[model samples]
Target: MTRLSRWLGTAGALALAGLATPALAAGTQAGTTITNTVTVNYQVGGVAQNAQTASDTFTVDRKINVTVAEVGNATIVVSPGQSQAVLTYSVTNLSNATLDFALTTAQQTGGAGAHSNTDNFDTTNAKIYVDTNGNGVWDAGDTLVTYLDELAADGTKTVFVLSDIPLGRATNDVAVVTLTATGREGGGAGAMGAALVQTAGANTSAMDTVFADGAGATDAARDAAFSARDDYTVSAAALTVTKVSKIISDPVNGTTNPKMIPGATVEYCITVANAAGGAAANNVALTDVLPTTTTYLSSFGILMNGTVTGAACNADGAAGGTFASGAVSGTLASVAAGAARTMLFRVTIN
Candidate 1:
C-alpha cells in the first residue's frame, strides 16, 4: 500500500477508466486517499525538450457495512440450577476497509416486540468473549478481549456469549442474550489491519497522531453502519433418580430362581435418570441407604451406565460403591438428558 500527501482539490478533479489488461492491486482500503503524479516530455520550438509533472488524488469508496448473527439460532440448553450457559455468534467485516469491533452484551427481560421470546428473567454476569481458539467450546485458556483486532472485508470471527443463569429455573424456562458490536478504526495489530498504536510518520508532530486501534475517529462504523446486534435463547436442566431391589441369591435355592428369604443376597439397583425437556446432566451421583434388616456386601454389584444393556459393567471406574454403618451407596459419573443410568449394590438379609 502507498500513502502520499497532496494539496486539496475539488471532487471532479479525479477520473477513472476501464482497464483492458490485468494490473497489480495495491491492496488499498476503502475511504483511503491515493495520490498519483504523471510527467510528460515535449519539444518546444523544435529546439529543446522539456518535461512537466502533473498530479491528482482520489479516495477509495467501497461499501461500508457489518453483520452480527447468532450461530445456529438454536436454543441453548441449561440444566436445572445450572449457573452458566454459552451462546455463540459471528461478526463479519462487510466493508472494504479493515475495522476493529468492541463487544457488549444485554440480557432480555421478557417484553413485547423483538424481545417477546424473553421469559421475564435475565442471565446474570453476562459477558462476550472472542473464541480465540476457533473452537466452539468455551475454555479457561481463551482470553477475554475488549475488542477484536481489525477485521478485513468479508472476514468473520466467532465469539462466545457466556453468562451465569439465574438459579431455580424450571424445565423449559427461557431467557434471551443479546450481543452488540461497534466498529473501531482499522489498522490494529493483525495481518489485515493496523497496529494498535500506529507508527510515527514523516514529521511526527506536524499532524495529529494516528490514535490507537479502538481510539481512532473511525472507531464507529461508516454512517449508521456503526453498530450491529444479534441474540440467542437459553433453557434449563432437570434430573431425577429411581431405585429397585431384587433377590439375586438365596441359601435354599442356591442360584436358581433366587428367593427373598433370610440369608438371600439382594441386589439393589439405583437409577439416576436425565428426564426430557432439560439440558444434559453433569457429575451425577446416586445415594441409597440400605434397609436395617439387610447387610451390605463389599463390591457386590455392577454399574450399567446410561443404558441397561450393550454398555460394559463398572470396569472403567465410571461407577462405584461405598458403605458406612448400615447404608449402601453407588453413583454414575454423569447422565445426559433423555438418558438413564443404573448401578447395583448387594445386600444380604441379616
Candidate 2:
C-alpha cells in the first residue's frame, strides 16, 4: 500500500491523542522548533487505505524584553568627599531567550529625581559594574562591565553605579543617575553581543526579533531597552570656624581691659560650629601656628572643648591639648548639628 505525504506551509489542525503540554515560566524558549503533524485514516471502496500525513514546522521568534528597577525605595545617603558611592539596581531578563544587555548611564541636570528631590549636583567618575557574587552591594570581586553577558531568560542580576562625591558639595544636594539596558544578541563567550535589529517586513523560516520591552524612565516602549533612576543625597557636615582674640593684660596695664601692646597676654579662641539639619562633625582637629614674634605659654593653658561665653571662649575647658613646633593643636571629639565646640589658648606678645 502507498502512503500520501504533504508539507503544510502554515498552521493547521493536528491529530494527537493525549499530548502533554509542558509548563514553562517564560513560555516556549526562543529558537525552539514547533511542529505539528496530522495523520488521516480512511477506507476507499471498503478497502483499508494507507495513512496519509501532513506536517507544519516553524521556529519561535525572539521576544526582547527587560526590566530595570532600583533596588531600594529610598535615596542613597552619601557624604561630601565620599569615594566609590554606590547606587544599586536589578536588571531582569523577561525575554524568551538568553541575551546580552548593553548598560549605559546618564546624569539628570536640574530635574526632579526618582525620589522627587531636585537634582543639583553631578557625581564624578561614574562607572558601571555587575555584581558578580549575586550580592547587591558593589565589591572588589565585582567586575566592571559595560554590558551583561549571556543572562538567561527570567534571570535577574544586580548592577551598581559607583561614583565619587565632590569635596565641596552642600548638604541635601542630590545627584540623579539613570541606568539603561538595551537588549542584544547572545552567542559569543567572554565578549559583548552585537546590537539587535528588529525584523522589519515579514516572518521568515528563521527566528525573527520582536521588541516587547515596556517604557522606562529614559526609553520608549518597544525599544528593546529599559531604564531606571536612582539618586545620591548628600548628608554632610556644614562646618564653620571662627577665631577671636582678646588681650588679658599688658606689662604696664594689669588685667583692667588691657591694650594690644608689647609683652601683653592675649587669648585666642577657635570655634567650630555645625549647621542645623546637617550631619555631625567628628574628630575635628584645630591647629594654630604661633607667629615668630609671639611665644606660646609653656604651661598647659591650652583649653579644648571650651564653653562659649558672649562671643568668646571661656577658659573652663579641659587642658588636654599640646603645644609643640610653634603650633597649638587640639582635637574636638564631635560637634553635633546646631552645636559648636571651642578651643582656647593664650599667648604673649614678644
Candidate 3:
C-alpha cells in the first residue's frame, strides 16, 4: 500500500483492537460466578483476512470558508486649470485577502454629449471616476478613472484624475471609486462553504465604496457651479474716410505768363479734407515739393478758402506770389473735424 494508505490501515487496525479487547476478557468473582456481556460491530475492510472475511468502511466530509474585511475610504483632490481639473484619489485595502475594484462617476442628463470611457477613465475593468460637473456626487454618464488590478492586504492604490471637469455644470460634482473582493478558495477541503458558493457568480457585489460631497459642498463642485462668472466680453466696429473735390484752371484768369512767348498762363485748384475722426491742428502743414519737370512762373499765386485761414494771394500779392523754383510749404491754419478746405494756384505750364 502507498504511504497514505498504510497510515490509514494502521489507524483502522488500532481502532478495531481497542473495540474488541474488553469483550474477549472474562473474570470470576470471589463469591459468585461472573457473566460477560459482548457486542460485535462489523465493517467493510479494504483487504480480506480469509475466505468469506468482512471489512469496515467509513466516510469523511470537509469544507473551506473565505471571508473579507472592510475596505478603507478614499480621499480625492482636484487641481485647477482651464481645460479640465486633474483629480487624484487615494484608497487603502483593509482586508486580509487581496481585493479587486472599479471606479465610476455620475453622468449629466442634458446639453452636450456624455464623456467617453476611454477619455475619462484610465482603464475599463475597474477605475476611478471624476464627476466632471462638480456636483459633489456622481451621476450617470460621468467619467470613469480606471480599475486597480489587485490590492494586497493592507495595501494602498492611487488613481489620477486626468481632466478638469468644467464648473457651471449642475451641482454634486464628485470623484468616485469602488473596490471589490472576490470570494475564492481557502485552506481546508475540496468543497467551498456557504459564503464562497453564495457569491460565486456575483463576485463584484462585495465592493467597498467612497464618494465626494454633495453639489456645491466640495471645492470642485463650487468651482463648477460658478464657472460662468469667469467669462470675458469683446466689441468691434468699422472706420471710413470721406472724399474731397475741387477744380484747377489751366491758366490764370487775368494774368499772363512772363516766361511764355504769348499771354499763356495756368491756374489750378486743389481740395483737402480731414477724412479722419479727429481735427487737424493749425500747425499741421501741407507742402508741394517741386519736381525737375515743372518750370517756375512769376505770375502764379495761391489762394486759400474754407475751414483754413491765414495766407491768401493774388498775382502781385505779398503773402503768396510767384511759383518757387523748388520747395513750397504752408500750414492749413485751422481745419475743423471732418471738414474740407480748398486752395487755388495759377501758373503757366511751361
TM-score of each: 0.52, 0.86, 0.23
The TM-score measured for candidate 1 stands at 0.52
- Residue-pair clash count for candidate 2: 0
**Worst ten in a row by lDDT for model 3:** 226-235
| TM value for model 3 | 0.23
Estimate, for each residue in 1-350, the C-alpha lDDT of model 1 and write its tens digit.
01222222222234322233333231335656656565555787886577755576556554445667777755666654445477777877665566787676765566521334545566777766888887877788666766678777668898887777667777656776666655566454852333233334543322122321222112343331333233334444466666667777799997999899999988766666667766666666556777788887775554545355443223233445667766655556667677777776678898
Judge candidate 2 at residue 254 and give its lDDT.
93
Give the 10-residue window scoring lowest on summed lDDT in candidate 2.
Answer: 9-18
After superposition, the stretches of candidate 1 with alpha carbons farther than 4 Å from their true spots are: 1-64, 78-85, 95-98, 111-121, 131-142, 152-155, 165-171, 185-237, 241-273, 277-283, 290-320, 333-350
Candidate 3 lDDT over 1-350, as tens digits, reads 24444455546665675686553111111122212222233445765343332233322111111121112222233312223333344444433334343333333222222111111222112234534454544445456544334444455554333344343321123333222222232333423222223223422323212221123211132111100001110111111222222223334443322333233454444446554444243444556655554444544455554333333222231244224547554555655545555555544444
List where candidate 2 sits over 4 angstroms from the true fold: 1-25, 37-55, 249-263, 309-312
> What is the alpha-carbon RMSD of candidate 2 to the true structure?
4.1
Candidate number with the higher lDDT (1 or 3): 1
Give the Å error, residue 5, model 2. 15
In what order do the candidates fall by lDDT, top score first? 2, 1, 3
Highest lDDT among the candidates is held by which one?
2
Candidate 2 residue lDDT tens string, 1-350: 12124343233423231235554555568998877765778999999899876766778899989999999878999989999999999999999999999999999998889998999999999999999987667899899999999999999999999999999988899999999999889558778888899999989999999998889998899999999999999998999899998888999989987889989988888999899998999999988888998989776378888777667677887877888899999999999998888988889899
